[model samples]
Target: MLELRPNCECCGRDLPPASVEAMICTFECTFCADCVAGPLGGVRPNCGGEFVRRPVRPAAALARHPASTVRVFNPAGCGQAEAAR
Candidate 1:
């Protein structure tokens, strides 16, 4: 299951369970569309992978599955050195 992370790793934007703005890499590194499209430049810095829109878990399913409470923030955006790899 996707962790459905609660915030943008790059910019710390709140991305609730149903947010259409959330994007994730295969590793589940979550970031906002702005971060993915702008700073991230359509690439995941940590894994050097492409990103896709995160799926929204239905509200009923969320009650049973529960969205993750952990927040991941990368204030520097994608690390330049890491991205170049």
Candidate 2:
């Protein structure tokens, strides 16, 4: 199951369970559309993998599964993410 991470790793933007603006990689590395499209350039910096839109977990399902609350913000921001990876 998808972890449905709660925020963008780069910009720290909120991305709720049903957010259409969320993107993720194979490792469930979550990011906002802006971060993926702009700074990260549609690739996951850590994995060097292409990103896909994160699916919204249905509200009813979320009650049982629960989206993750852990926030993974990049202190150095998105610009340095590629090199850091």
lDDT of 1 by residue, 46-76 (tens): 6778999999999999999999999987778
Task: Encode model 2's per-residue lDDT on 13-73: one tens digit a residue.
Answer: 9999999999999999899999888878777766788899999888889999999998888
Q: Give all candidate RMSDs, comma-separated.
A: 2.1, 2.4
Stretches of candidate 1 above 4 Å error? 77-85
lDDT of 1: 0.86
Q: What is the TM-score of each candidate against the true structure?
A: 0.90, 0.88
For model 2, the run of ten residues with the poorest summed lDDT: 75-84
